[model samples]
Target: MMKYEEEYWIDYIKNNELNKKEASELLNLDIYSLMKIGDSLRSFDTGDTVSYAVSYNINYTNYCTASCPICAFYTPYKIKKYEINKPNKKGYELSLDDIKKDIEKAKALNVTEIHIVGGFNPDLSIEYYESLFKEVKKYLPDVTLKAFTIPEIDFISRTHGVSIKDLIQRLKEAGMDAHTGGGAEIFNENVRKLITTPEKISGEKWLEDAKLIHSLGIYGNSTMTYGHLENFDDIIDHMIRLRDNQIDTPGFLSFIPLKFSIENTPLYKMGKVRYPSSGDKDIKVYALARAILGKSIRNISVYWVALGKEMAQIALLSGGSDLVGTAFSEKVFGATNRKTSTSIEELNHLINEIGRIPALRDTFYNLKEYY
Candidate 1:
């Protein structure tokens, strides 16, 4: 184990320029000391207030072409068409009407953001998204529409024969406020090849696309799906890549660590990953993220749906500053048998229980109100 003076680590945190070696050393520190340093860094950057968003998750469709081994949400197109009967079939391509209904529900609940992400279905045209965004803006003009991951954008751009630059410009015109941070399972190419399909874009491609998105004056969050096949070094490398990008583009609004949901997925059946990440590991990851990313990425969100409420609260004290979102009607995690849906009152209570002020934020981390 590498040894460093406590004051030295504190100076690095104060300077907010921890390199990979320094970060790795921090990760090896005792859990309590690590959490203390992480919490202190978080306090120095962003004060005691914890933030969340009044947002709804709209999974437009579960019919996917990628069929990644790590995903449980997607249904094979063939199985959906042949094996499943009409009334019993769980897979679906949601119609415009269904999307409109969801938006209306979100609007009625006074939601500030609408998160739209789904499986990579090749059948959906660019016009489908344009029309959907147009109608969503027409219905809820004030709500922020954070849609599509970089991989999804890459897939759609390739399928539609439009440049990604052009696609993003058109979507911006159609009212896409920002992008989500899904599809970034792990940045290490070797691990990605083992878990995700070739249909998914590479991590390098995802970062390039993110730089492009940032160049367009739109900012999006970054994410890493951990606790599956990646080791600590892989996790550190992922955070370092994100840190380097933020250093250049400075467009990432937050870094969210999504704990892998291991149930009912192909990875589970293969007996490669046996259990969900422990609370200890979850807290450590959140802390290491804060320790490494430092001030460049100000927000670290503990995905409540993935970590569950109790662990999520503990994570907030350790390093996380955001509770992700309400995640109303979320389906991706549901396919893995995890529940993240919560009421506004519940969210407020959770944050408050941890002695932090609970604030509702928009897609861009703009504080809407404190309850």
Candidate 2:
């Protein structure tokens, strides 16, 4: 980007008045200034440092239709024996029965929320999810069910030939409450083409679909997949797209800055996962996300899988509040977060160590029972 744009981002970050274009001067920031910006944003309003057992994701599946190249979860059309030093395996798609068993396990753990999202299961994870949600309510009525994305829904629609809105309504009626924004790696068409390509829905379509979901009253989180190939400009553009979209529908709950990892991903095979820091460009995006998203979004998630427990604890102090929920069974995000699953018990203790409450929250950020 032009040098002047970098200046604009610095001032806009500090002042919060400039439009997205002018404020994205961050694209031109020198290393030192960028670090300071990251530091400043890191210290911004992350509530209650004491760890609480607020929640963790109950990861439901490892199967998906869109095998985005940068993906961490799904395997090649067939199974692969690769387990990235973690317990995750890429080929096993959990069935509705498996999901039910997971829910039982999570309820036993006293988890307040179940953050369930699986890949585009052409084999009926859609109606399966409906059954899962209803069964969850039947068994553990208090536990919240915040599940899946509209894009996954879109995939199902194409696979099933139903309209997206109709799919959303069906899921909602069946017991899916909110959405957790995975799948939206970055929202720029050019960067997306350069990075994620065909496996993903385009940046514009993701937004359009997300907006429609919100209009339908399903609140959800949004995220960007960075650290692979795109630079700061692409990051800002993605943030701007979401920020602007939020002006229309505040239901866009939070903007997450996802770090890229090469573990078990096509990008890694291309050799894109190395950086000087313990993590890499993904960590940079985290600090940058804090600096940019600021308070417009209520929460920023640090997935234990990719960041690992130690780095994630550091992230809590660095402008991250939402520690992602526990996953009973997750092999996908496990690939990126770098862990198949982190128990709620472990996360609560970790956040406590770092002086942040592990506030268990539903997909909509509604606090759950602290267990």
Candidate 3:
């Protein structure tokens, strides 16, 4: 067992790389001490610049085959096929016109990124995504298309009988600039089984796909969903795995510690999980992320939609260097019964209120404008 001393941990964070045992010890530190260490680390790694994106989230469909217990956005493709029910309750697939209208709104907002992710709808083929990506590019050629998650890509590959390399190349040809970091709930096998369904890709598969994505010259953010059915050890292990993977592949631009929203989801209704994470726990995850992956993954993103506005600000002060984005049409969090709307003005206000320099960033974390 490692000794727990604030002084020792502080010095370790500053001078040495963290092992899993050391990371677990750091997670037990008091919130204030953790925040202090995390803040210092953040300042050293990224300086005082806090970045955000003028981005729009487009959930192309909610008819999902992977009925993950952690998700409320999906309506179970089986149910959708049998009943053909309404959206937000049963299932919904947005038409090309629907996506076009959403793109129009994003254009009006001058969004730099069009973030798209959705379920593994069996009906949708590679051609569907190809056309969708092409249309999005045609309408807004300047905006970066950061689309698809590891599980989504894996499922599409298996369902459509396409190789991962071929699928990615096709998407790139159709204007997929990057990938999103969803579907990485927890890397631990037992905990993941509790939170998500078997239909979802395994943690190892997720990592493999990420490596392939990076090898293909595409970069994107990575995430770990916490606050449900996981211990400090699990969190530490997750970050370490990500750290090692970043060392190996070097494509992940940011690490996002997503606070699991339990309301309106199966995880809550099944009585397997009890409540959302407390404010302190949320902040600790941010701090721990910095301590563990601060050197490897420089950008720690504070996803405000999962953590509320105030917690988001606190996270920025602690370890987070980015405020995710202004998720214009975010529906997954909305399905969890949380308000999921924000604007560039609101994001800037939130960052300014926290006294960090707010900068508008593109999908690649390149600072486009500073305010």
Candidate 4:
């Protein structure tokens, strides 16, 4: 254990440009002390306004070829039902009409953002996404259409014989507002290999494509999936890498510390990872995000579906300033045996209950309404 004087470390964290060694040292501070510094930093940078997005999630398909070990949502192509834990959870693909219907429902909710991501389905082509985006824009012309991860983009571009630049340009013309930071599990090569698979894009490839996307005038978020086979050093390196990238391109709007949910996933079933990370560790991860990247990525999102509503509230006080979104009809976290449903009303209540100002925002973190 490292000796830490809380006041000194807090002042140091606020005053100086933190290097990797100093960040590692700060990780050893008491969890409560870390939270104190994180909350203070949050107040200083992002203010007391806690933001949420009125958004809907559209998981176009669960059929995937990239069978990452940490994923619970993917159903690989031609996989036998009985070969998996849940036989009833077979793969299914949604047509363009089905996606339009989802958009109609989202429009009924007056959603300002439409979040779309899915598995790397080999059957879908670049034309499929083009038509899908065209149809979505035809219906919800005003809603911000944030779609696809860097891995998904890379897969679609390579498998369909389209350059990444051409793919993103075509999608932008078809109506892609932004990208999601889903496939960035972690930056450390060893830990990333342990959690994800070869089919998924490499960490280096993810960052390269992200910079390319930023150069195209497209914006996106960043995430680090922690709590599974990753040490403090891995986490610190991940943040630093993202911080450097943001400095280069100025594209990442937020950094979301995604907690690895182990239930019903390969990591859990294979005896490689037995349990979810503790609440103590979870809160500390949020604080660590604040300490490392708070200045660079001002919005640290507390994903309620992964942390549960109560724990997510605690995370808000720790370092988080965004509740992600309502996450209407989310399925990925649900596959991990976690509840993935919440309403705007419930989100507002959660923020107000914590004695913070609740505000709705769009994909770009622009404030929409204050409650």
Candidate 5:
């Protein structure tokens, strides 16, 4: 294995050339040293200001076809289809009127972005999304609509017998601002197969679609769902893949290291995974992402909805430069029995408490205001 001194890695970060091997070595460093390197890199890239977005999350439906082992938010439609014959026990597919009302609520709060994601319902056609986006634009033409993950997009494309490029074009024409980076659990083929369902697309396809999205002039964020059955090597591989893709396309807005919430997940029930990521591992992942990705992907976001306020604060000092968003109705983490909502006021206070400047940003990381 390649060994390097602390100064060697530090210089590599300064030069914006930290390799995958050097990034992997950072995990072995003492926490303080690792954090110092990460903090320095973050400060150099983004300065002392920590950014966030005033956004709302709308999971249009919870009934899904791919009931991946890692997810607790999805209610399998096959199992619950019969329940629809009963009363209120079945899964939901939000109506267009319901979505319009949600958009109106977001507008009332002066939200800048509307984050839309949901389960891959085989029943919903591509026209459903097109109409949804079109109506959102009609209600709030200015609000940024950051919606759908690569997996959801892939599923929709295959279901409609259309190409991903074609699907994205139609959505963009309707009103999709950018794609979310969920569903990328771990890029390693073997590790991903073990964690997710077989129906889900591979990491290779995810990158290809992301590149295609970037080529079309729509930028988006990237994410990794860690703290599951993945090792240090798996983590490094995931970051490396994201970094390489950013180098090629350069449209990734940020990198979010989502700590796996295992409370209500299948892995937890099956006795395969027990706990959420410890605070130590959480900080290391965020910090290492800064060191590894370097200049390739600048923004490292700490998701407050998943990590809670305190750990999210700690992440700011470590390497995180953004607090993701003020998710008004975040359900994914809530389904896992974790806190899933934060306000603009609370986010500002958290960033200030950490002695960093707090700012509001648009979905594209454009600074709206600095507080």
Candidate 6:
């Protein structure tokens, strides 16, 4: 840990020479803290575990300029010579009527939140969402609408020559209630350039965007796209950056660890990239996040698309406190070659299997009860 970052608290945790919170002095935590948090959760679990809620990933467009190597969700994306080709989708954009049907289906299924996300579609604008969000709100105003990423906002701003600040404002005013934390690949530019680009805004930029949204009384989640070109130092640096951001604005409800899926992307084929630790690596990642972030961040979610439901259950026992996305009919994985979605009932069973109760919550972690 000292090799990664030099600090007294980090050294004390490595040496195991201090007491619990004493070692956590100045907000540096270690593996033992993770075990303590898990233990505390267990002690507090009164046979009343929180139920996982209904959420859906809304991919507005399949187009992207990022061309991230580990991504499986782009259309007409240029890939390397060695990677497998993804199936072609005739349509790149999800139509306004299609979005309406999705909303109707989500309402019929009683989804609490619609996680709207997609590529950096140049044609997509505030008007696109205005029509989509207005229709969704017309059908079901109660459902929380979680949408867009910092990069998406940036892309929209660049395409329409609007600032990201105003773009976010328009989206919020239109209907988006929260952010999805997608653009934050890694805070370090060197790592980002390998996957995304330096122009895509740094992790510090992501934190600023999150702060702006949180300042408006809206909440958003944060993420780390791990198991990619990043070194351990870069990965840890990303987490530390998010943690620092939380100190300023604590509205981030959870930290999602995005596992890199290598297929239909340039990095995997052309650059000869590999994700050696795919699923099992998350145990360490989640445990480390819980330890490092300590209790300041309430939930650490295991995204099932990246890690399957069974593995996510294992994560819950290890250190994870939330199941991310909670999506139905997720197209992100399909874009990546692993088309999969889980219903609320399946999520409930998964929570039970992991020895935790499934609690349905809105985009902001507000529990929505069924009377």
- C-alpha lDDT score of every prediction, in listed order: 0.87, 0.65, 0.89, 0.88, 0.86, 0.67
How do the predictions measure up, each by TM-score? Answer: 0.96, 0.81, 0.96, 0.95, 0.96, 0.82
**Candidates sorted by lDDT, best first:** 3, 4, 1, 5, 6, 2
TM-score of 5: 0.96
> Which of candidates 1 and 3 is the stronger one according to lDDT?
3
Model 1 TM-score, 2 decimals: 0.96
**Residue lDDT tens for model 5, 140-193:** 898899999889988999988999888889999999988887788899999898
Q: Quote the lDDT for 172 in model 2.
A: 85
Number of backbone-clashing residue pairs for each candidate, in the order shown? 0, 29, 0, 0, 0, 10
Model 6 agreement with the true structure over 283-347: per-residue lDDT tens digits: 65765565555455667777877877777776676557777746787887676676777677777
Error of 5 at 26 (Å): 1.8
Model 6 lDDT, residue 182, Cα: 78
Number of backbone clashes in candidate 4 = 0
Clashing pairs in 1: none
Expressed as tens digits, the lDDT of each residue in 142-261 for candidate 2 is 766777765676677788887878888888888777787777887767767766647567878888888888898888889877767776678777776777778777787676666666
The model with the greatest lDDT is 3
Q: Candidate 2: which stretches are off by over 4 Å? A: 1-63, 76-90, 197-199, 272-283, 335-337, 340-345, 355-358, 367-371
> Candidate 6 overall Cα lDDT vs. reference?
0.67
RMSD of each: 1.9, 5.3, 2.2, 2.8, 2.2, 6.1
Model 5 segments more than 4 A misplaced = 1-8
State model 5's lDDT. Answer: 0.86
Query: Which ten contiguous residues of candidate 6 have the minimum total lDDT?
Result: 39-48
List runs of model 3 lying over 4 Å from the truth: 1-8, 85-89
Query: What TM-score does structure 4 among the candidates reach?
Result: 0.95
lDDT, residue 17, model 5: 63
